[model samples]
Target: MTVVAADAAVSQVDAAAAAASTRPRCSTEDMLQLLQDYDCWVFDLDGTIWRGNEVIEGVLEALELLRKLGKKVLFMTNNSMKSRGSYLDKCLQVGLPAHVDDIYCSSYSAAAYLDSIGFDRSKKAYVVGERGIMQELAAVGIESFGGPDDNEKRASFSSEMLHDTQVGAVVCGVDPNLSYYKVQYASMCLLLNPGCLFIATNTDARGHFTPNLEWAGAGATVGAIKGVVERDPIVTGKPSPFLMQDIAAKHNVQPAKSIMVGDRLDTDILWGLNTGMATLLVMTGVTDEQLLVAQRGSSNGVKPHFVMDSFGDLRRVAQQALQQQK
Candidate 1:
């Protein structure tokens, strides 16, 4: 062919590719076929599944579909304000059926890890955060307690617990009602035990539901405590391997075959992308489509292979993958 003819042919190809790009996307089957290349499902809570007291539409259906398909599903969250039991209650409240074993929290991971390293928590503990952190410590078979005693079951707390105990380690999490005593106690413990591990559930500054005015999550609190004591905390939540390790160790999830689905680009998506796992960004929570796409353009490695508006959407995608395999 002549040179001019060759140039014309290339232009036509370019136009065809552009036209296909702007065309409507694939159906649910297409999406699943694309996603089923791998098989692990790691879901994030708060915004992706539920916001405040309301469950996101199609969430339960999505989870149910995943289970029926025999896909490995695990629930993971950075919120340290609640323990696994608290998460269990939240799941029930939101109409998502989940057992305690199915959910993983930062506090649970942090406490279990600390216990494995030979920190005896069952004797006496000086807690620095909320009910969730305390709940996790209790689950680790550690005897740590914080604040004051109001009755038999609950540890009615004040700033006094910081002054009362000999101290082992300092745990940090969201305590919206964070009293001055809590901070004082944490600082005191750090001052006493410089070798104490400072474990924080997450560093997210805001809550998904409320986004409170005084919001500075466990990360900020850890900073404050560290500043006073001149130390740094070991974070175990989003963008960290702590929660991922917890799930893989306890569950049958295979990272090579697993994918992380979350609403937040910084936490859930980043966790997977950075750690060599497949990532899917859902529009139901903290991050929507626009935000993630924009981040992908700016950051070198922030894009999820799959972008979804709802968990229900994944059901179709799963079926498609199964079909494609055959």
Candidate 2:
């Protein structure tokens, strides 16, 4: 080849190498390096770790390996139906290694948000959720009423109920026992009280309760209240920076040195991106390979830095790395 042609080819090769180095690693071949690169690993719970009541295969093993490697692990979930203590219990029940401090659920986030805002201690909150929300609120010394109790109190909407101005905030989450009365009370609390806060644990559209069905999630309840009140709620779950910022500050986690692994692009991946952390998309729950591929091809899509078929793959990668070292 001519000297000029050889020089041009070498330049092209160097340029390609530089471009490749700048791109995020997606291939499984780089999993070992990724495992070593991050100091902290943040995981999305529901889809990435477990679906319904069953734990995903190899998840426990992977978590054990991460702990062995001295990596800081934290579980973050948008499921506001349960408190952090309940989530810790679920993790222990499923044989997953976890600590209550390492778990951050939307239920806790909502309470923390209220605490951060200097909510009046004397005023009570009208809860349109499960016991989890109530538990977290109480833990922070915030009194709440109207969760399951309101479900059975399906009395006619009385204007007198709105006259009670003790309710300073209206907190909503996924409630299987949601009733019109609960909605009516929560809506009235927000409408009548001038400074009554409207807070939603999350706005997730669907939840996985059973293996075959998708149940209406907190968004359904949040939407119901939003539709009636004509006001946007302050969301405290995934894709919201409040929880992420709190975690970073409290845990001293550096975004650059942490990786967020989750199953959903919109919530999990988007949350990671919003918080300046590396993101890994796992196809174990709500997201599938087809959906991931389509998202990657979309012009304005949010893509993860890495993609794994399942979180279990991390266990396999760790095993392989260990074997290679031996």
Candidate 3:
């Protein structure tokens, strides 16, 4: 994850506009052809696969159908609330067979970025998130400090309080128990400490993982610290493009032979477009039909190559594809 300018992101949006102009929405024949074309399918978890505690009705069958057709399946998520293991657990709990290696989240991406950069484990990261951030870092042998612990709870901080000198980075994620103290301490690490890295799992404003409970997302915590520190973070989640590259490198996924399915237009669709992969927008989570129509011809945001009413629709297509393969 590296800090990128607003212009860099805006430029991606503009590029997407030009590329999308020549493409038409998928027809029934196009849908079946798409299923036949891709050998790998990457799906967003929160809305595409499951919503809250319940699994999206036909997605489980869809995944099975895809696997039966010898397709590789992977889960890509921007929700940094949990580690990859947790996500895998959730997938299995809801009846999807998920292997640990098949799950990817912003947390793991951040860890991989740090690992690639040879981050000094000797220096601790001042965390402004939940235990998941710490857990992922630990899995990568990176040390972190200050998240959801009793000592971090209700801690008093003033301008006079001494900053932790050993803190070399300010890592932010989804902190449900976010306090002013977390922001203050993280800001101090970034502003006062020399050579401090500012990292964010994702910059999503809110979470839609669970229905009816709109939780403040990791972006909120990152934004709070960014406001205090007057800096931009190296976002390691969706829309980063680096993440998609990493995915391809790790899983040997060919861009032309893989597809990304998600409910969010900005993050999910943008990631796919930016990384040269096919994008599918599902109407199960964030983006609705009205918004999709309004943005259809806009040059300011990313557009999907195909749009489906739900992943269940994709499931039906995959089912047909499987039958034809027999």
Query: Of models 1 and 3, which has the larger TM-score?
Result: 3
The most accurate candidate by TM-score is 3
lDDT of 2: 0.82
lDDT of 1 at 86: 87
What TM-score would every model get versus the actual structure?
A: 0.78, 0.88, 0.89
> What is the RMSD, in Å, between candidate 2 and the native fold over all Cα?
9.7
Shift in Å, residue 135, candidate 1: 1.8
lDDT for model 3, please: 0.79
Candidate 3 has what TM-score?
0.89
- Which of 2 and 3 is ahead in TM-score? 3
Residue lDDT tens for model 2, 1-326: 01112123434554543344334335667788888789899999877888788777788888888877778999999888888999999999988868898999999989999999899999999999998999999999999988887777774635445435899999998999877778878888899888999999888887776554668889889989998999999988888878877778878999999999997788889989989999988766676544555677788888889876667778988777666755
Q: What shift in Å separates residue 120 of candidate 1 from its native position after superposition?
A: 3.5
Residue 57 lDDT, candidate 2, scale 0-100 = 79
Candidate 3 runs further than 4 Å off: 1-25, 150-152, 155-159
By lDDT, the better pick of 2 and 3 is 2
Candidate 2 — which residues are off by over 4 angstroms? 1-26, 157-163, 323-326
lDDT of 3 by residue, 1-326 (tens): 11212223334554554465445446679888887788889999887787778777788988899889888999999877689999888888888998898998988878877887899989988877777778999998988878887234554534356678889888888888888777778887898889999999888876674664556788789889888888899988887877766777778999889899998888889888878889998766776544565678676856798876667766777777877888
